[model samples]
Target: MKTKDALYNYCLRLADSNMIHGQRLAEWCSRGPFLEEDIALSNMSLDMIGQAEMLYEYASTQSEAEHSADDLAFRRSEREYFNCLLVEQENGDFAQTMMKVFLYSAFAKQLYESLLNSNNETLSGFAAKAIKEVKYHLRHSSEWLIRFGNGTDESKRRVQQAVTNLWRFTQDMFEMNDADAALVDNGISFTTEALSAKWQLNVNEIFTAANINIPETNNTITGGYNGIHTEHLGVMLCEMQYLQRAYPDAKW
Candidate 1:
């Protein structure tokens, strides 16, 4: 891929990851396990949506036609989204949600750190702004993970199961392709391979602090970066795309 194509793909991947995860988190709106958690989840959802808007807006500029950020977010098919499989997984329970958030925030924190030095000025600026928000996100999720992991027997058991179930999907977050390679070579994007080590170290420390044991399972699932997704993504995209598809050109 050319430099521009690589940059466009990189931006879209970032946008899709945030958009999908934000949509998932928004499902918790008014449905959180508690009042305070409800507010926190909604705030995180808003933050992720804001990040998606910034990323997709940049992606739109790289496209031939004038595509709006909403268009890029809600009008795309599941096969076209470049988010990792982990973000699109269904929110099973409070424990499961926390697990997902913990994993994603850890990765995002590292990703934004590297992106701060991107050769692409817009990407670098966006990363500089987003890293601050991601820092809070990481702290919040890590605290929740620690609480649940060491809270009560039931809480610990449920969160442990959630971590086990979600672990397979974690591999896809660091899965790099030719686009990533191109961007990394040109300094337009950071290599996720380099970030993965730090991400794992951070996660491991959090797990230890939480009194949770890392699963010894070696079954790693992949394929979302190439547009292949689990069954859940279709349902997510259907609900998310309904308004835009039902009434084309509709705007709030």
Candidate 2:
């Protein structure tokens, strides 16, 4: 029973991460720097939304409540969300947005790689399916990272500032809690410590080539796993849930 509860929480965390990320990316729909870049970000948003739906669908089957995907998504309160701080962060500038994307895609790619071998078939399958899209996400973000970092003086300055500002949130990506412990012990999930190391290596490789400065501070922000988030999340949720909250069960 404890394991079951842990699994449910784990699933919710994964679902929340993807859903919030997609929600944030959707904000870039028409706001991208260029028409082509705009469409690319939109496509990435759809991929994340689809991945969230798949995870939520599986999560819906796990508990007695039998919650639907939409319920787990639109109906959940801010305190119920388990997304990491990085994705829920406000989209600051185009450089900031791309920095967050690169950071998250690196983490997600490593995480999904670990999940591929999980004993839980639902999780493994979801990882397998989402990983391909994550690869594209990484490629796109990394490309931007290079261009922005190695471009003009202003572009380099902005991307560097974005990295420094967002660095604190990176630690949240490797956090582990009771649910994570249970999942690890049960062979349903692995320790994020290992994934974090690989992620750092990948980041270093790219940053070296792109001339992007890695932040020096080791300080980190946390608590999103515990349903505590930045003020930005509340505003984002209000926008995201307004329709569903105002018109419950009004699906076409």
Candidate 3:
């Protein structure tokens, strides 16, 4: 693949994942367990969306069609989105939500940190800005996970179940594809293997402290990089793109 095409897909993968994950987190608006948490989730959702917008903007510059960031985000079909399957999973419960947050933030933090060293200036700058946000995200979710683990029987049971259910999808986050390979060759990105190893170490420490064991699951679900997502993503896009699709170029 040409470097420009590779870069565009790389940006789309990151942007799409952030965009979808932000939308999922946005669902908690006004529904958090408490006022502070509600606001926190909203703020985090904004952070993710803002990052996605910036990435989408850069991606637009690389496209021959000269698509806008909104076009890239709101006009894409489900098969065109490259977000990881892990981010597209339903937010089952507060515990389930936090598990997803903790896991994704852990991986994101490492990914962004490594990107800080990317040969691409734009990506490195994005990484510098994003690392700060993901750090806070990791801290907030990690503390919450620990609380759930040690708080009560119900909390423990719920969080434990969430871990078991979500563990299978975690492997999907580390799946590298052709775009990733091209980016790595050009020093624009790093290997998922190293990222996964660091992610696992950090998660292990937190899980050990939280009294939550990593599930012993041999099954792994992937293919999101290749645009093969769970049914959840298509449903999500229908709702997310409803306004854009129903009224083309409509604006507030």
- lDDT (10s digit) by residue, model 1, range 1-252: 887777788889999999889999999999998899999999999999999999999999888777888889988898989999999999999989989999999999999889888878898899899888878888998998889887999999999999988999998999999898898888888777779999999999999999888789889989888899999999999999999899998867
lDDT, candidate 1, at 165 = 87
TM-score of candidate 3 relative to the true fold: 0.99
Better of 2 and 3 by lDDT: 3
lDDT per residue (tens digit) for residues 1-252 in model 2 = 388888888888988999999999999998999999999999999999999999888888886796899999999999999999999988889999999999999999999999999999999999999999999999999999999888999999999999998999999989889998888998999998899999999999889878988888868899888898988888999999999999998878
Each candidate's clash count? 0, 0, 0
Give the best candidate by TM-score: 3
Instruction: Specify the poorest-scoring 10-residue window by lDDT in model 3.
Output: 175-184
lDDT (Cα atoms) of all candidates against the true structure = 0.90, 0.92, 0.94
In candidate 3, position 77 carries an lDDT of: 97
Best by lDDT: 3
Ranking by TM-score: 3, 2, 1
CA displacement after TM-score superposition, residue 143 of candidate 3 (Å): 0.3
Judge candidate 1 at residue 132 and give its lDDT.
87
lDDT winner between 1 and 2, please give it. 2
Off by over 4 Å in 2: none
